[model samples]
Target: MRRLMQIACAVAAWASLSLPLSAAPTEPENCPGLIASRDALVSRAALRQDEVGLTFVGHATFLIETPQGVRIATDYSDGTRPPVPPDVATMNKAHSTHFSYRPDPGIKHVLKGWNPAGGPAYHDLTVQDVRIRNVSTNIRSSGGGTEYDGNSIFVFETSQLCIAHLGHLHHTLAPEHLKKLGRIDVLLVPVDGGYTLETFDMMEVLRSINASLMIPMHFFGPSTLNRFLSSAREHFPVEFSNTAAITLSRAALPKSPKILVLPGH
Candidate 1:
């Protein structure tokens, strides 16, 4: 089954990266064919965990602590990881900011996107209640040249959260890219406004996908942030926050689309 291979591949996928071996969590069942998988449900990650919380360390970086005491981290940095090991960690090869490892003994699985031959490296796989996949988009170099670096979109099924991290995304999402994205709950988008792509092009990408929450990343400067907010505000409400981490649950999600901008800590 697709789920089995993905679950099995989950171990092998991120093997090339460096992280604490004990941080990976046990792969959930009904993976590829998650019955809970819904297409039009845009809800917050509201899974009630007895002793868990989610934290966003930085650009495309997140820490998801599940109800079973399972903590999954995304794009962990070597010197930036928490003192404790996460049950699982997801990383992309787009930039150095998205990958790192600590010599911890409590972590379990470390996942990385697969680089393709003459194409973007995309490591697409699904875990128990988690689905971590990638879409290959053209990478526009500083001057010229085109490098195909795969962009990964991680979907947390149980949380009803389909999050797409545009790792140095050069172009807009292709037809296949949208298909893979399914239904994005919270999109971790980059807001260079011009550096990455023209505001018009970026707007098209935002319009193409119907994600409930659009979380901006990759850009700093108050003006840059303001530009992003202004551009996105046309389609949805932009809510800024002082904290990067949010405890999301399905029942507590927004009824309409919203943009949650968490402060960079």
Candidate 2:
């Protein structure tokens, strides 16, 4: 009887060890839940016709509008607001100008990049025609130490396009980070020589991502923006737009990667 009891206890221990860890759930690049609802959502939004509109809102902010009339403001803060209230707003608290504590009550979804309680900030939800998710990255703290998961690279997927905004990124991306990003069609990046990654390092990141369209943001003025543009011209053809807004579609993407500079709002 004693031997049998020992055998039973050992089997129970082995079973527990074989069980998968449930403490931390792994978030996939393309969440299955978001895909599951696509059929229902896509059928309703006939206006998009496989295209989306992107408008530069200045100072690291861009307004993304989906075909189904869903609007999203990236890096939303007190400094900038869409002409009309956005259905969703994604903010990175890297600086006072990138995030606001008091957002308008009319805005529906407000996503923050940092987890104040000391964990990775996680956002994985779909609203209307746009599905939004985030990959957490570290930032430099005011005290000068590294703050882990202090920022997020927000990705918006809709109309078969993946748009990513690198919010206050300070370091080069790791292999793991790239894996989470998947395939990015359009990348809204910071071109400020010093505030974000150094110009050369930022260039390296741009090459690594190999996005089809690179939009410069967070630049103080034309001088810094021009410097990045000259370096980028080596790889991507530079195009300056007189307007702040541009409509994009998968079918109409440029044959090659290009750096598109848009007027700040």
Query: What CA root-mean-square deviation does each model show from the true structure?
Result: 12.3, 17.8
State the local distance difference test value for candidate 1.
Answer: 0.55
Q: Count the backbone clashes (under 3 Å) in each candidate.
A: 25, 0
lDDT of each: 0.55, 0.75
lDDT of 2 by residue, 86-160 (tens): 899998877988898889899999999999898899987789777788989998888988989989999888877
Evaluated at residue 231, the lDDT of candidate 2 is 87
- Write down the TM-score for model 1: 0.70
- Candidate 2: how many backbone clashes? 0
What are the runs in model 1 whose C-alpha is more than 4 Å off? 1-53, 101-106, 116-128, 141-143
lDDT of 1 by residue, 1-265 (tens): 4543333243332112100011122322211101111111111243343112446565556666555455666666664565467767766555666677453566677765535355555454445545455555666555577655544555454344445566556688887777655666556677777656666677788788766556677675677878877878888876654344554544344666677776652
Give the lDDT of residue 60 in candidate 1.
55
